[model samples]
Target: PPEPPTGVPPLDPVDPRYIGPFRLVGRLGAGGMGVVYAGLDDRDRRVAVKCVHRVLATDTDFRERFTREVKLVRRVRAACVPDFFGADTGAEVPWLATEYVPGPTLADFVRTRGPLSGQALAEFAHGVAEALTAIHAAGVVHRDLKPGNVILAPDGPKVLDFGIARATDGTALTRTGGLVGTPGWISPEQYRGAPATDRSDVFAWAGLVVHAATGRGPFGSGTSDVVVSRVLSEPPSLLGVPVHLHAVLHRALSKAPEARPTAAQLQQAVAGLPGTERHADAGSPNRTWAAVSVPLTDPREWIRGAPRKRSWARRHRTALTAVSGVLALALVVGLGVRALTGEDSSLPGEPSGPGGTTGGSAATGGTTSAAGAPDDAPEEYRDLYETGEVVVEPASQDEPVLVRRLEPSSDGGEPLDQLRIDFSEAVSGEFVDFRMTIDLEYLPDHGSLTVHSNEFLGLRAITPGQENLDFRTVGNTGLLAELTPDDPTETVRLTFSGGVAAVYFVPLETRARAQESLDYPGGFCVPRSMSGVSETREVETFPGRDYIGPLDTTLTNGAPLDNCAYTEDSEYQ
Candidate 1:
């Protein structure tokens, strides 16, 4: 027997009582493809089921495309996106069911509640960037990421309705003639008819941020064609944005995709904002923030031409002028803010465990306890230990890679010198294919990196073009790779062992709440010297005066050993 429709809305004349096994409860709305209905499963759980329009449902080509796209969308697994439940393309009116998220759209929220501010604003930035990171990692470009597509749910912001998302590998369903996104929030590349990429979505994300903060897009009000033309030609108007976010958003709304930060880069940059939260584990109460130099994917992407000193200060001054006197302190220090004086800033659904990660908090400021320590020391560093995340930006890449900075926990009262590393990202396109390359450390001249790993995952090194000096220390086994003798900008392969390992990207619940994976147990605990007299050093330099790295190893007391080096090289997996 056919299930009866759950009556709650003015349904479309063509709306069916049921699609596949689920009964349609009410019409949610419609997009270019078809009408969406609030659906219920056999056990009465809710799901958002979108059915293809009658006209397109009958077309075999469109049907095949719809089927393939649904499968592709299923690949995304971020908490920001609703869970993909199932899809039935063979049904008369093909439908896709996803976990139904009850919330008002960002557009509706902004229209009614005015603009988001303070911690709410910061959380939204982090959440959206997290979503973009997940989406782009899956190789999908959400061509339509306007406020209307984002829903403000009880938990946090959840990006929904991938009505026009296209796979990055030339799998666009829409033809070339018409615009593929909503105006004002649409990227300039979309207006110019250029193919969309991850960076393109970032451009739209900036517009979304602007709209969320000021209740309007950067382009203001205009006809769709006018808005498209304005996006194509003029710079975004950030008049109403707070000082801290303005500096970041300006770069995000760059006309050139290359000028903008990648989704991963944006995540790093947003951490410095006053309202930006840090990721810490509820289980690991003893573990504090550590300073780490993030490795980039390439060396060339860092050069944005002409480093203007006092530029950030100048922007701070501007933000100060624009904001009320009450926000003076925040405007000046907000860009460099790194507050670590409260409960860990873990977001809703964020996994917590005995092992947690600092998503490059070193970029904001390493936490430190030195009385004479530079005012700019990262906030992630703890007082007694040389532990925290280090953010590295090399010549070859834009995305920041994380390296742990751990020191033997100490009981000393004196300040200690610390270590800093310069890293250039791998230029090889085979990063996806190159499995088993875990646990890497970049050093300068003659210094080697000491790697301490979890039991299941061990660290061992391979020889690169330049030889590593033979050095041994107890409680710490050091592995180091130097720049090729001739070219400081040259690329090299630094391999690792302890059984082939790769970061498992599968999403769902995991045993390790702090571990952001389905399989990998844990990462290495990199040790640093916990002594006094801190200083900074340069690693290497490029022709355009863009040099970043210099091994800064110190000789202070070591912190307590989380896990010492593995003495044996084999017989374990």
Candidate 2:
């Protein structure tokens, strides 16, 4: 057990195994204030055990706050939430246990894949909104509702981590002047030092909806300073958001809390979207998760050098809703519209993920509008077009289908500018074995370009940045690949026969640029195995130039690259 990361504290050597009567197994995840471990009860049922940082565990005030959270959990009666198992604030290393959910976080799902389709987005949003309603009904404010806090189980979405949650009637109140959450997920009221309210959760929930719809956060970046500034003064930008849920997200994440709908109201507003599965316990079958045990190691090595004064500060680097009733009468009618439509959109796959392409970028063609952008673009480029989607094939020991498509807009204005295809859940292989196809209107002067490709994995980590992408994990997941073009058909196809969790494809030229700027050598991009994933495809066009690029660094190996391209000096280069 390396010293826990910022949120989680190092385990006590004298008492490492038990939190009261629950026996600890191994860590499930680590965060700013605590470590969540897989633990078992006498019946052998597995539960997620969260241990409070020793510093806070010993503080009387923090103890009170922690206990309040326990009470709050008990009050929230929604079947969507995990059942509270127990809380032992008095232990040398205080801990709490809740039913364990066996699934990836919603953040992981979208990053590995792409945004949820219109129907899926609607359904997911509805479930989250309803969960928020239940929390508010408990008279507690969740305070934080970000992508990582949401778990998308086989059943539906389950909200987790009530550590910063505050009970309206509890004796403690936000530790007096302390800020209690991740910046991007904090509500405006939270930044203003106002006591949190149910509406506070609404504000954060709104921001999350925007993040889910687009691959970016409403504030544009997840940096703490940027998020704080955006929440305090910026208007929520709804451009590129999945059209069907635009109005709902706009209203929910409104700058003014008053303008936002209540959690219950939001639920009603998004009621009955497609692909939302309602499970009895948010996919926690039998209120337990599979148990796997691994030996724990001393965490001192990783944390020893951290300065004592900054211990708390270091931990702070880290850190939802409801539905509404409307003019209840009007809500009923509107809900019908939402329900009957089932999220209308022409795009293939989920609307929010990396698979779908919206429209022309601001670069090559200025002022082009996305499909749902109130209306279509001007006549000049209206005819020009492009389409993209993330494609996946179940794991196969042999070559897998690899296809690429690029086409100009209706009138042949600009070549289909930027293209990216993300293949998730594909295993990594020693060699990059895949085929590609590209077709485009002829370039004015450039010689016709043809491509042959190959991708490989086996490389060293970038030395300039954090070598350990997962700062707290026991080991790192490393990947490398190379692509070489070999065909001439307007329609190109290739196959990769290997193991990989997923594969990402971008336009050849765009990829060349990304490889150069990103990996430094200018032709390769290797992501650490444990790195967070993203599938965003951002295409921007200048008045006469088209450039395709990534929206954010979802697979950031904790290194800075040149505009998502690989640079010569980069480790992968």
Candidate 3:
């Protein structure tokens, strides 16, 4: 099995094989709501398939929200957003497919390549603002817009993952009682438990730009509690952020959501920035990927431009003439009408036009009716007007799930290098699972192993045992395990010696759900919806290979556990 693209990892035993007509080739990434896989359509075009976690899909409310949001997400058509292909919300394991963007995430790019600056930073700001404009125009609010959700594609920055997004009409999709967005990137209103709107996304957009300009978030890094407090009380530190963008970002990060500019206004302001001339030129297809060399000027000055100072006489001349004409007409009508009608002045109710009496049209300011005639026509031809707004019934919020504890330990048996994690909340089930991927190509000296859980783990629950697992070496590979728990995704990344040679999953005491089926004789079971067989079944037969086997419950006691082991050696020690 050949390695997939850069950020994409090999599909694990637990992953689905086929989602609808697309063949799942590799794992793009996973999150709380679902797992994203890289798949190929019948036309062989690559797409990203996002499948909701079984735990969440089982909830009727969640499925309804997923179904509704998918409709709204499809309405978003923007260059900065991934193109939506299709979805099956009613499937056993509901999944939606989108265009696969072959680019590193904004978080990964900033971590590996360093913070963006100059023209690259300008374009990034403009592109993200453009994405917000498209999303808001379609009546969808991107509840989560962190660095991880943004992909720095070759064409521009693409905003991905509308998994938590809801319509702008105050439709509550955060049924899970916990806060909807990531810690530092979340806006003040969201922290205060207010419903998220397009303005909330604008606030997030400012924080994202700040993170891109500087390597860190606007609120700074700390535990979730500390970060949340700072976001609520303190002003964002825009220190390393370019001076030109200070005013807009400061206003955008205002404590009051109403103070923030609308997405369209934000786009206009970003488009007016000094080095964003290329962005303003719509006809130019060849965009500059590299940083543009331009002097930093006051963004406010550019955005406002030069004010046209008009003389007082020139401004008031038109207004004075219009007022005089109206007064003269009123006086003449008053005198002539009385003389024509002989004091009563009330006209008979007679048909005044070819269609009918012109009274209705006069009352309606001479507006045309729905029948292509004046509103003065018969009442039967009058048109009933509506605001054209979609009324989405609000959803009730669900109780929040709190983590009682998170325990990490080594599997002291065969394949001693494997690590096992147990959550108090029963995170590993038929629908809920975890993902682990190793990357040894990018960094030469050492490799990295990243493990992500679909469940949310509190910082306090996992911090104490973090040091206990640091000394454990990964099998005979001699790689030390260092746990770096990511708050947003509940992920842990461990640095190891050299690169990853082989990855193996030991059989756990968990059984496949009724909706899943086994892929191979000894391979792990996958979703029944993805039970479609591929045309070719290739197998690897060597050491130092990326081998992810199925969790065979037949060989072990039914204890409901799973573990991952990595070793450079050909055979298990």
The 0-to-1 C-alpha lDDT of every candidate, in the order given, reads 0.47, 0.45, 0.50
- TM-score order of candidates, top first: 3, 1, 2
Q: Considering lDDT, where higher is better, how would the candidates rank from best to worst?
A: 3, 1, 2
| Weakest ten-residue segment in model 1 by summed lDDT | 552-561
Query: Relative to the unseen true structure, what is the C-alpha lDDT of residue 430 in candidate 3, on a scale of 0 to 100?
Result: 30
What CA RMSD would you report for each candidate?
26.4, 28.5, 35.7
Give the lowest summed-lDDT range of ten residues in model 3: 385-394
lDDT of 3 by residue, 438-519 (tens): 2211111111122211111111111111211111121221111222222112323222222222122211111111002211
The lDDT leader among the candidates is 3
Model 1 C-alpha RMSD vs. true structure (Å) is 26.4
Q: Candidate 1, residues 167-257: lDDT per residue as tens digits?
A: 2123222553256667787777767778887888898889888988899889888788787788889888988888888877989999988
Number of clashes in every candidate structure?
47, 88, 3
Worst 10 residues of 2 by lDDT: 470-479
Per-prediction TM-score to the true structure, in the order listed: 0.47, 0.45, 0.49
> Candidate 3: global Cα-lDDT?
0.50
TM-score of 1: 0.47
